[model samples]
Target: MWNLARVAWNLRQSRRLSFAIPPSISATQIDPSFFKRGLPFTTCKGFSTLETQESGGLIPSELLTKKTVLRPDRDIGQYADLVTRVTNFHGEDKGFMVLAGDVFDVPIRKDIIHRVVRWQLAKRQQGTHSTKTISEVSGTGRKPYRQKGTGRARHGTLRGPQFRHGAIMHGPKPRSHAIKLQKKVRRLGLKIALSARTAEGKLIVFEDLALPSHKTKNIVNYVTQMENTKKVLLVDGGPIDDKLKLATRNLHYVNVLPSIGLNVYSILLHDVLVMTQDAVNRIVERMHTPINR
Candidate 1:
């Protein structure tokens, strides 16, 4: 009887112990907040909250939908100084002057610049590619085989794609690749390009560009006086001086263009832009002109 009583007591103790201890939970199954709080519980091995958070930080949804403005001028200044100088054919400095607020101080428009460049490049393409089609080929129109008598498959003209020396299929033809752009867009592009050059301190203004003689050495000597100039694109307001043209023609690094020929492509192509006072005035006037529509 005593031995039966001891076994019953031991059974009750075992049941109480089973109810006191809770079942083990996996780290993944535990609530994330539980780990944030100092809970005295062991998590499953190889699971970490720090690892997941460190992999990628929380990104706001609004940031993903935000668009970048091509011409953002929140803190850009309104006016800039124009460095001006007059030099003779011998590169001697005749006079120095500072023109204030000469170049336009507008925000840079990268998109407009890109479009203008693409349009200019497109217009330059000759697009003279040509190919002969089946109809234009010089093959005879006679049929090669009979319809019913021959065991071989029936054949048509020799100009067919299956035959040798066949006409090109869907080949290119001559056409113009010029892209028409709006006048306002082109104007804006030029302004942005000029502004960009001025902002980078690459714009140089001259009182005038004239040469006494057509000697290339004289022009080279004059250009060598300009500091930090690698490749030069010289622009004049009116007709290009004949002497200047002849002097710059042989120069591989120097290009001469009239004020009317100043475009975004040519402006951005060269490292340094050398413009005469007349050219700058004409450009500013052209840019200020209101479009009809």
Candidate 2:
């Protein structure tokens, strides 16, 4: 069945884009070279649609000429879903899957990702460093020597900062280094990280991570087949499998994480991301889920 609403929306978008053309350059004067520079695409309604290419090419008016009348009422969002293949442990092609556009194909924002990473690292820091103050130091509350009697300079006590092994002044103390960050930013950072990996072709979806034995060689062989994978991140939807964990623990280049444990920092730390199909589903659901805030 054809979607009437989608067709109507597309007509409106096309009309708006056409009206954006420069007034001096009539529709007949539009350059043919513009079509070569852009690709045809269609806008979808939701996050969970398959990526589609349509006949009409949506070229920006700026590409033709910057000087043009603008309308604030036009929606400029161009969303496209990502489609990737799902393979098994043996690298067999299981099938293709459609990932949510909002989760796996969002526009990358490096600043948001950086802020979230800094937040995570700060929260993980153990601010336990401390220094003894003059009052906290153990020493007698007596003058070092008589004032002006000896050639040495007068001192209040042995625990003074001028004396050797004395307490430090204005030194570091134990405290929390964590900073406040919005929950929405953290969530968007995760999505952007995933989208970045996907756009770079470093993300692979596996059917399952379950293995027959805990042999390290099984994982080693599979990992060796990959290209330029200095470090690999394995994500599963549920609890990590025992065999998978044991097999990968010995390999320093490989790391396993549950879907619930996925964060922006961990995703950015590795070179390639290998996730199970279930993991992808869980991530998409989590991205769409609402937050308390």
Candidate 3:
């Protein structure tokens, strides 16, 4: 009877322990905020509190201002100084002056430019072909002279290795001549190139490049004063200036292009680049964006 009583007491203790959940571990289960409303996590904005927790925090939005007015009274010389320092080119050290109010501020990617030019040059081939062996050539059904003594050299088929116009052996086949550069590195290279160009007085900026009519001579004269050279690339921010377009149309070395059409090839090909202040501002805005973060 005493043994039965003890077993019943132990059974009741085990039941009580099993029914009670520990307080310390309870907090780790369902979050208490799940029951709440109107919080940032519970709000119906497509994002859930659970997601926020998973991602480690709220993702900050990129801040952009539409009304970023550019400083017209810019020191082009100072701007060129910055570019020279960044690109590590000797243009600034050489005492090259950058004229303000021109489209001379161009972004460069030196590494990318170097790689691209090198790739282009490496693609050139010597155009040499190989010679084919006797076994691979056609018309070798029978031996000309039984491998042994034939007063004349034991000649095989006409299409043999010794004959002209035979198939080539161990020749170069079509393959990719491209060198792979990382995306980040390529972008940096372009920036460096632009910086170098800016330091070199290659980027030109203008208030406006268009005219009322197509006066090629007027455009040439204007560019000659600004660039002091016939070779110039006139880059505009918006629509083409009709007057500037007409003026440079006949000039062989002058090319008037839109800002959106700018490329590494076009930027590097010209002796000088002329741009409007607005274009420079746009470039600065683009470069200073919070992308580096």
Each model's total of backbone clashes: 0, 0, 33
lDDT of 3 by residue, 117-236 (tens): 565455554445444465666665665667677667776556654667665666565565566555545444445545556666565445555465675666655655653564777777
| Top-down lDDT ranking | 2, 1, 3
Lowest summed lDDT window (length 10), candidate 3: 83-92
What lDDT is obtained when candidate 1 is compared to the true structure?
0.74
Using all chains and alpha carbons, the TM-scores for the candidates as numbered come to 0.67, 0.73, 0.45
Can you give the lDDT of residue 61 in candidate 3?
19
Model 2: which ten-residue window has the lowest total lDDT? 46-55
Displacement of residue 17 (Cα, Å) in model 2 is 40
**Model 1 regions lying over 4 Å from their true place:** 1-103, 148-151
Q: Indicate whether candidate 2 or candidate 3 has the larger lDDT.
A: 2
Please, what is the whole-model Cα lDDT of each candidate in the order they appear? 0.74, 0.82, 0.53
Worst 10 residues of 1 by lDDT: 59-68
By lDDT, is 1 or 3 better?
1
Q: Which wins on lDDT, candidate 1 or candidate 2?
A: 2
Estimate candidate 3's alpha-carbon lDDT, on a 0 to 1 scale. 0.53
Prediction RMSDs, each to the true structure: 17.5, 13.7, 20.7
Q: Is candidate 1 or candidate 3 better by TM-score?
A: 1
